[model samples]
Target: MESDLSTSDYLDQIERLPTHEREGQLFWKLRIRETRSQLRHLFANSRLRTSLVISLSIVFWIGLFVLFYLGFDFVVGQVGLPGATYHAQTVQFVFTLFFMSLQIMLIFSSGIILYGGLYASNETNHLLTLPIRDSRIVLYRFQESLFFSSWGFFLLASPMLIAYGIVVSAPWYYYAYLPGLMISFAYIPCTIGAIICLILISRVPHLRRIVVGIIALLIVVVAYTSIWRTLDIKDADLLGAAWFKQTFRRFEFTREEWLPSTWLSNGLLEAAREETFDPGDLPWFESGKYLIVLLSNAMFFHVILLWVGGLLYRSSYYGLNSRQARQTHLRMAWIDRITEKLLWLLPRETQLLIIKDFRMFRRDPVQWSQFLIFFGLLMLYFANIDRFRQHRQDINVLAWVNIVSFLNLAVVGLILSTFTTRFIYPLISLEGRRFWILGRLPIERDAILWGKFLFAASGSWLPCAILVVSSDIMLRVSIQVIVIHQFICLMLCIGLSGMAVGLGAIMPDFREQSPSKIAAGFGGTLNLVLSAIFILLTVLLTALPCHFYFMANESKLQTQMIPAGNLLLWLSLGLIGVVLLTALVTIVPLMGGFRAFRKLEV
Candidate 1:
């Protein structure tokens, strides 16, 4: 370390230097150069990773766009009267719901992300040592938090809006305004989250988490009550006008002019509705009005964020660090005891490793909070799933019930895939810098991979199993279907966990400290793509035989007799195929990861 006198002399010399306004410009200019350098490395050094990620992303995007196009076409051409007012209203209503849901998700996720970055990261400490203003640093980090939280928002939102544009035959201006509108709309929730994060940390350091919990609870209450009311339909009303009315009414609040989602949805729909291709058409004014509203709000929020950050950022940093330094004891919970008891069959080292991973997740609110928000939404929907069911023995209805059950299983599996991708895939990569400690331990390197796999599998299984059971119970499916769903859930947990852990070992990013960045890399993208392919196959195989069985059993007048033996044989074959797929998915990855772990240099 340099002597205090020398450090003081250097600091005094630095203070005497004049600050140029363009120094801030210089920072961003350097940032762009660094980004270009990284992109060049991605293209030049990692061509395979680049190609695979791009191809997979395009496939995913095109698939979603096609689904939206078909749905919109059906609603317009097949549903209700051909030229009816209902078509436009229905499209606008859906747009409102889509943007509104994304708004709530962005705000919640942004808060969690900001907390992890602003308070928890060591990088923030390093940034504070530079000559930059605290507000400037906060703004830089805010952009990161926004991007991290909203990439999924962009991916899901853009396709739907673009598909709607095609269906409506909108003017090119609609597509032109889309990127700007989305950016402005997304900025609102993220700004709100940032403001809340700063105030909570700076003013009430002790009550920050409690405040966050209260906010989350409020959001949950609102979401649950609103959705529950919409879903509280009688079985007799299935596919009837009454069910549609209630559902639409529940989401009607989304159209309130005060809401930013309403602004975006209205802007897109209005612009999409314009038939004229003229560059300066009078019809453009309607959409342009909402666009102006969105932009003005974004600019206003931008000013407020900088002001708030300037006021609170530095103090919040110090106060937060001071508070953490004084806090030491971590009391063990009953959950830990139960976890140990449940894993008694595992070796001591493996058990300890699992326990360590469990604690880390528990300590990180960003991880568990997201888990609860997403899975909790599913849990809510599953509990209320009976609304879509009808007791009538109509063959179509019964067939739909079976189809939906299989779809529910698919949904749960897809979500678990994302969970594993986001959190589990980073496990080995996170350990890269710290492998020396494990190297000195008595445990073999292979145990590290196994421990992560087991933790991912068991931890994901419980909630997913509950979700599947609840969905089946509410749908009133037969016990056989429920058993099948449970089996599929187990298979998904094992396969996804194995894929994430294995690929994580194979292509670990030891140098990148951020988990979000790690998960966004090539390996995580591959794991996600593989998981999706696995789910598609599993659902197709299982749903086909079950659909046939349901159709044969539920029909009032049987046109063709179907043998129980044949149905059983088909179902058995599907399950056998699924089992083999799951085994290959789980085993191949784990074995590969173990081999890689053994040969790892660090």
Candidate 2:
């Protein structure tokens, strides 16, 4: 009886074993190997991997970095000793504050972008269904998030850090402080964890729908405030070591004055203050500040990693699975039904495309929010142009016309580019697996392309045309010049719209992660081309007219044929420049894009 019971227990143990530990171990192992192999291939394909260019570039950058580092180091080293000639402590304080502010901003913005857009998206669902372990999936996604966030931080702080390092003559070990490498990777996982927690909690019956956007906005606001406060150096000059000594006697705030970053800044100062590289005098090593920072960083890094590996990973996976589980079936009456039906007037295909674009945008608020904020700031900036024209008397008629014209040009560029990535670029890519259906459909590709073109162009220009008319009315320019400028703006708007759609169609990346991401890869270049062309045309239009007007102003030959001809020449040149630039803008991109789209497989 005892032997039979033991055998049954052993059999149950074998039955309950993990799949990898059972008969499928080899297959599971092979699957992991295959997954890794595919990922490696994708990585290799994505990277440019230019050995010579990369090496040369790195060398050039590092040379510049070292040069800047040495210069700063020498200056800061001179200031470290007692009775130093430089009373630049306030300057150092200001710089430190500035650096911290920028750092905070980068970290916070990165947090919002990663948390709401990347980490909480449908991609997580796709990843979860794969055969890979959840931990590996989490690690890979986090690494990708870190890669993007770290790059941003590097770009923001590298120049400043280099300048400071040079001024302070920082030690060889100080080279490890490469802007954001240590803290970014550490804090990023914390942000990821926080985002995961928010996602999980927000999945309650009432919170899921708007929670992501609200949390993202809150994080962005907090980030902005933190960055602003860090750099708010009000009356910094008056608060010196002597003031600190007295203030400390009366208050208990002295201890917290030396924050971790301050310690780092001061430690660098101490190291640089030394005349020679004496091991004994080197404050970084002697004061053990570097060790403390290293320990703190190490602790932060491990804690974040463990949490990400365990709790965050599980939460992210579970939260993503259940995020929108209970879709609210809002009670709709007859009017709501009629309105919804009316909204569906476009053909099913067009409606689907538009709905998809809007839904994706609405779901991911970070990108659209950026556009809104930018528009708000620009409108606020140019709302009152009285300051620009305040002290400048004798402003010509063309100057007012030019100001209105330039503003129109700017409005067109800004609004159109916002949609370049969102609506234009993704028009083709959004077709995804269904792209093969085009070959089977009776419709020509041009018909579909034209539909997208009309969609993007009409949508962008509606606002642009309204802006032109409003600006004309506000500035009270001559109707003749306004009409001509309006015509010019119309042509340019058409041209820019074509360029946006065309470039986006041609360089359409089917596997785009987000519209903003697509914009970075291709839409930005297209906008740059459009902006440059418009700027050049604007310069010629304004400059040539101003020259002719000034020439006319100086001369008494208002009725002379030569002066009339000269005025005609400037206007003709302006019109011709606008015409040619607009032509290049439309024709060049459309043809190239048509060919590119025709050749595309999917």
Candidate 3:
């Protein structure tokens, strides 16, 4: 009988054809095939189809890099002194602390990625059933996580490093050393993260919640510590000496001898400051120590990870696949009761949809953890407003207060936009392959869209309003300013939520399972771009009136030329324009979303 095996089957047979080919060669072959398949699918459209898309993407990335480079260059120039290495040290300290903090965050995030099925793709699942060693599987997943997590670091750090190099006039070897350092730095996190995930899977599955809670506690502790350190209210004996001492002490912690950040910083700075470039007299032994430390540590941890995986992979994989009852049922029941009481007034269908959305959000630790981190960081920054005021005495205090409040509005609006893009924009698309079940229900698509909007808006609005009101209170701004900012935040909430929902519905992607992937598609890109533009315009509209008022007030006091009545007339017209713009932004996108969702073929 003729063989009826498919190509994949034939490949498998060929793989088993040689016993020596089962380990490294087999893994590479599978990986190569998988990568090529993805690439082909990604570029399946005709050449003309995505030309505009490609052009826009290139422009966006180039603009981002240019913006960062310019910003870093400006910082270096401003901070550089005529006869000192002060600017270089400052930059090194900042980079070290930043990378250290990022490493900590990556450890927690990696555990979540593994536990939450973020890497549980169809290909990975299929690979698990094959004859490949579990160590190879772990290695593949580690590489995937590392690649996904490192891009942001590369984009952010490259410009700063390049700017630092330019500021220091470093040699070519200094530039060459940077990529190796970065790669090693990236490897440390991936190795540590993989180990964390494996340990959690093998030892304590139920401890994930506790780990997240501990991370939250750590954030709170750090926030409190920062506030305490920065908000010293003791009256200083007014002398130039005290101010100089305080300024010098600001970064004392960065000089600690024990930190990896310190090592990395010192290494980079030493390499950059090398005065000789002659091949015979290179500072190999001295400058090379940091690189060796970084590389050895990375290799050490990665080897340990592989060894641990080889021992624990089978049990952990089995445990990870097993279905265990979640322990939060009682807490969820209590929340459901509260939700029921709150939504008793809504229609039954809407109530059910809202409840479902809440349950889904609550069950997903990856989603909620991210929400916590993003907003928690914002809150921490907001909590430091009093400290900001104490330090910024050069400008008119009230003028500074108003400026910060207005800028706070923009920042909070931008946060809302990001939240909507990351979470809300993916909701409709996240229905995924089971969307047909919704079609079978007796509910209207409008109800579904409305529920998502209301839920997302209300969720986003509370935090944003708190941020606005708390900052205003901290700054002791006038009640008028407080109320105005609150109003603007409310309008922003509606507009952002509406735009995300509408754009998501219009360009739903049910094929992609990951929220991050879904949000990186064309619709998500457009939503982000439009949302950013909307925020800019809104800020300008609101700020224009305030700017006019401030200018008019200053001129009235200084020159007595501009009349108060003229100022009032301009202010009234500006307020009217703002109100109209807010209404249009709030309403149009929501209606568009509803209509688009209704027309969607289930």
The C-alpha RMSD in Å for every predicted model, in order, reads 3.9, 9.3, 5.8
> Candidate 3: which stretches are off by over 4 Å?
1-83, 118-123, 233-260, 274-289, 320-334, 340-346, 391-395, 520-526, 548-602
Per-candidate Cα lDDT values, in order, are 0.83, 0.53, 0.71
Residues 1-602, model 3: lDDT tens digits: 23655776878865674353457687678779987875676578434424544665566566666776676667657766212456655566567667777766666655555443323566667777777666777876776667656655676677667766776577677787888878887778777878877876678656665766677667767756755664553554222446435544764675676555666676677667755566665543555788888889888998898898778877876776685865664344778778877888989888878888888888776677777776777677777777767666664766777888889889888877877887899999877366789999999878898889888877788889998898888887777778778877887888888789877876688766667656656667667767877887777776767655765565455446656676667667766666677667667877777777777765
Q: Which candidate is the best by lDDT?
A: 1
> Any residue pairs clashing in model 3, and if so which?
none
Model 3 lDDT, residue 482, Cα: 84
Q: Please rank every candidate by lDDT, starting with the best.
A: 1, 3, 2
Q: How many backbone clashes does candidate 1 have?
A: 0
TM-score of 1: 0.91
Question: RMSD (Cα, Å) of candidate 3?
Answer: 5.8
